[model samples]
Target: MEKAKVYYTDMHTTFRENLLQKIQRLMKSAGIETIDFDKKYVAIKIHFGEPGNLAYLRPNYAKAVADVIKSLGGRPFLTDCNTLYVGRRKNALDHIDAAYENGYSPFSTGCHVIIADGLKGTDEAYVPVPDGEYVKEAKIGRAIMDADIVISLNHFKGHEATGFGGAIKNLGMGCGSRAGKMEMHNAGKPYVKESKCIGCGSCIRNCAHSAITITDKKASINTDKCLGCGRCVGVCPVDAIKTLNDESNDILNCKMAEYTAAVIRNRPNFHISLVIDVSPYCDCHAENDTPIVPDVGMFASFDPVALDRACADAVNNQPVTPGSRLDISEHIHGDHFCDSHPETNWKTQLSHAEKLGLGTQEYELIKI
Candidate 1:
């Protein structure tokens, strides 16, 4: 198989040619023009920073992509699935507000913002992959499933569980509905730490299945009733409900790979990863820590797995900055996320993604 072409450009421009222009050129060079966008519904999957997190990709980049799609006669809309964690993006209403608050309004991006899943994050369509590790089928947002083309505009950053969140993370975990997120997160029940439970009834209120009930001045989860949706974990005032710790990161990464494969199987797809911010954590967090390294610019590709692997390699090759999160390591040639977060092995996602026929780890980085 020929190496996947991943095009990149360094962040070097003053006033005339900005990152947005560079992205447009990069996409074209990466062969995104091959897709026929005429009258097609293009879903531009992106993370609208969770209200307070400042590390998400800029709206200007989204606007550029939307413009390109529109120029090709495609009807584009910025979309993201509702988050599972109790945060600003837990539902469509709140998620849309957060997107607008973060400056991704339809006026700005030249497209409407649609939370892929409907109001409660339960509106989903099952996409069968036939062969999968943890999930034989992916529960994707109905609107996302309905789109004619899929494009991921991802903010590549370190992830606490998966080592790093890149294009695959953006497509798999990012596109899954809140309930779908629960499936990828844990195979066992979510345990409620009674000590931290305030019995505020928030969990009981948010749980659609009434899985949580307060009793004896403490909140307890009815494991029998619980579907392991993980809603209680987010709504708890105290850090009470939590997923089991025994689950391996490799398992989680593999599940994510399968879910992502379900989204793009037999569909026209494109991906772009922005390596700016370089935060030590995912943008899903309420706050972003200082960057572990300097901004490396942007990359675009037709193959998401190849694009992600290329970006991870680029980040690993750069010298770690002093006073940053990765200040300890003298050696940075291997996986940077693993060195930064020793407990995580990111290769699980890459290798599993390749096995699932999503894409390959081998890629040729063509500098644009």
Candidate 2:
């Protein structure tokens, strides 16, 4: 197979031709104009950071992408699935509020914000993938599934469980409905640790299947009835509910790859990954630690797998910065994510993505 083209640009420009110009160039080189966007619903998936975390991609970057979509006559909207963790982005209402608070409003990005899954995260369309290893079908958010095009604007960064959250993570894990996310994260029903339960009934209220029962000053989950949406786990006030670790990290990454394929199935898609603000953890965390590396530039590609592979290679080749979280860790390696989190193997995401026919890991990095 021919290597997919992954266009890149470094942080080497003055105010005259800044990163935004580079972004435009990168997208053009990557063939962003190839898609027919007239009258299309373009869903630009992105992570709006938890309110206090400052490491997420700036809304200006989103505006650049939104402008490109608008220029093509696409009706673009910035979107993300409601997070499974208890935080400001747990539901559509609060998620939009956090997005607006963080400057991702229509005025800033030239598009409205929509929680891909509806109000309580139950709105989904089951997409069948007959060749899937872990999941035969993926429950994607309704708005996301219904869109004519899917564009991922990812803030490439380190992750605790997935090694790194790049394009595959963005689509697979990011695009899944609350229940689909649960399926990718765990292979079984989620449980409530009664000892940690505050009996606040937050989990009960969030469970779409009504699997959680609260009485006697505690909450207990009925496994038989639970669909394992994982909303309960995120809604608990005290972190009482938890998804059991039934799947291996390798399997989880593979499942994520399959789910990602389900998301882009039969749809025109584009991807862009920003390697700046290389946070040591996912933006889901309220607090972002120091960056592990210097600001690498932006990457754009039609092939998400190749885009991620190129980004990971770029980060691996760079020298680690001193006084960062990566520097503090005694055991070091060429790969920053592995050096920071030794237990995770990030390659599983790419290898599995290839297996699912999402795209090839083999890529040619074309510098802009």
Over 4 Å off, model 1: 14-16, 190-246, 328-334
lDDT of 2 by residue, 66-144 (tens): 9988998999999999877678987799999999999999999899999998886778889998899788989888999
Report the alpha-carbon TM-score of model 1 versus the true structure. 0.88
Q: State each model's CA lDDT, in order.
A: 0.87, 0.88
RMSD list, candidates in order: 3.1, 2.4
User: In order, how many clashes per candidate?
Assistant: 0, 0
TM-score of each: 0.88, 0.92
Point out where model 2 deviates above 4 Å: 195-219, 225-241
- Model 1, 303-361: lDDT tens digits are 88899999998898787767877787554536679877888888899999999988888
Angstrom error of the Cα, residue 29, model 1: value is 1.1
Error of 2 at 89 (Å): 0.8
Error of 1 at 217 (Å): 10
Q: Which ten residues in a row have the lowest lDDT in candidate 2?
A: 228-237
